[model samples]
Target chain A: MSNFSVAFRTTGSVTILALNGELDAHTAPELESAIQHCKNEGAYNIIVSGAQLDYISSAGLGVFMAFIEEFRTLGGDIKIAALQPKVFNVFDLLGFPLIFSIAETEEAAVEMFSKGTTHN
Target chain B: MTATIHTLAIPSATRYLKDVRRFILRHARKAQLPDDAIEALQLAVDEACTNIIEHAYGGSTKHKVDIAIIVDPTRVMVRIRDRGQPFDQQSYIAPNVVALTRQGQAGGLGVHIIRKLMDQVEYLSEGRTNEIRLTKYRTH
Candidate 1:
């Protein structure tokens, strides 16, 4: 079985995805599908909670890059929160912070979406 | 001081990335590397293997990636060998991170991550074999 799984829930206008286990090339597609599912549900404000994410590679990071444009163009946004330091390092190393809003807590991310301050 | 060399071989496929990571982490833990160093080494190895599987083999699964780890008291060295097409290191261009993010590029971060994480990265091609060596120094 794959070591990664994504669970989804809705809090106010934000759709929260709780990711568990490692996120790498093999399991990136699962994340893509979850994001797509959120889009189908008319959720543009998406929050990915990475509290349980043990690791992330370029492939997993690529999944967010692939969909962020579409979400933003549609007046939605994807915010990442609660990333473990190890997982957050990958995003920081790649300069993702410039393009995405990463919060220290899921509630902060939801609040960002609620305030319509998705970027920065 | 001389260190023992340990080797692992896995198919050049994305599915085997988890196994490759596990093997590297085990060696890193045995070497008593710090948590940050272990994570960096793991990411470097994953990016290197992913490049081999995708670019070297053209996403084909027939090739195999052979990884050798040498753990010394102060540093860990990893050598990865593959039987795929030769990689022209000279022609490789570093991605423009700001531009790529603005353009929403989905890929191209693997090579960049590998270079940033590994203390030393060397690529060489001999005959039909391509080899990459990555090294990380132990912080504690």
Candidate 2:
């Protein structure tokens, strides 16, 4: 299997990215590129669905931190949902809950963007 | 379980991190650690290798990082040895995650994750080599 792959689509005004496989240092740049693609297309409100993400490292987490400011400044936010426990623990351990909107389902994440609320 | 040790050396590059993680996971699973513990070990090892590649080697792929996995009945230990720049473990300050997030910083979180996941982390320098040992005890 490929170490990582990203599928992009749009739902309403939100850009939904479905990430599969592992996200580490090597594959992080692919995700960065995907996020940049969204930005170039004028997508600010983004939802990353991690239902297929098997693992993530600090380098992977850094990608989100890198783009969050730009996204939020454009009146949009990056929200994550459907993370496996293994992947979610990494974010939770780093206290990402305080900084990012994380939901249990992709629909909920898109809903949060639509309502313009940070609450997960 | 009988005591066993396995070692691997790879270029200090981010691209090789996947192979490094796979090597550790395969051995960690054979050692029969819990799934969560194996995941934690993989993350911790990846962070350590990344530090060596980025900070120690200055993102140079010419150098090498050596890894050794020591499996015993009660614990699994990972030793990562690098010949890149010497690291000063004593002067290291753990990243303040809250402040980092506030400032929108993307770096400085790798070391913190390593410290949190490993049961014991020891860094030492011997002449030109820098070694980091990470250990996780069996839960059962």
Candidate 3:
């Protein structure tokens, strides 16, 4: 059985990807596919909700790095929210907060998109 | 806690990463490691093994990666060994997140994360065997 899964939902123009289970090299491709599916459907504004995500590795982090620019160029950005403290530490260690818009809650992240903030 | 050495051998594939993490978690708990240190060690070791699975073995699952956890009262250390290509440490430059995003690159961040999470990291290659050791000290 796979240890990680991504669920899709939508709020206004934003696509919310609710990530569950562990994200590592083995399961990262699944996330990549999910984001790519979003792109194919022309849904660029994204919010990755980590409320159910138990763990993440560098491979998982790379998925966001790979697609953030593409979405931004399409006039939408990927916003991350609801990361557990332990999961957040990995992102923080890699200085992700400086590059990605990481909000404390899903609603807060959706708010950022609605406010039209470019790099908040 | 008594000092002990534990070992787990798995195929050099991403699918086995969860088993590696579980081994580390079980051993680290037995060693009474602090929660943060355990978490850091888990991530650091995972990064190291991922590198081995991807760069060392070239995504070939036929190879094996042996992970050893050495635990003592003061700290815990992990030694991962493989017979694949050794990583050229000299050529590794720490990645800049903003620059990576601008260029749309996803990889080359594992090494940096390992260095950040572990107190000491060393890479050794002898003939056909390449090993990366990651150590994290317990905080009182």
lDDT winner between 1 and 3, please give it. Answer: 3
Candidate 3: where is the Cα deviation over 4 Å? none
User: What fraction of the correct interface contacts does each predicted structure contain?
Assistant: 0.72, 0.63, 0.93
Assess candidate 3 and give its TM-score to the true structure.
Answer: 0.97
Interface RMSD per candidate: 1.3, 1.3, 0.6
Candidate 3 positional error at B93, Å: 1.0
Which stretches of model 2 miss by more than 4 angstroms? Answer: none
lDDT agreement of model 3 with the native: 0.93
> Could you give the C-alpha RMSD of every candidate to the true structure, in order shown?
1.4, 1.6, 1.1
Estimate, for each residue in B71-126, the C-alpha lDDT of model 1 and write its tens digit: 98778999999988777778888887667766677888888899888889998888
Compared with the true structure, all predictions reach lDDT values of 0.89, 0.90, 0.93
Q: TM-score, each model?
A: 0.96, 0.95, 0.97
Per-residue accuracy of model 2 over B1-140 as CA lDDT, tens digit each: 58899999998888888899899999999888998899999999999999999999999899999999999988999999999887777788998776775567787888889999989999988999999999999886
Docking class of 2: medium
State the DockQ, from 0 to 1, for candidate 1.
0.74
TM-score (chain B) for candidate 3 is 0.96
Candidate 3 residue-wise lDDT, B65-129, digit = tens: 99999988788889999999989999899998889988899999899999888899999999999
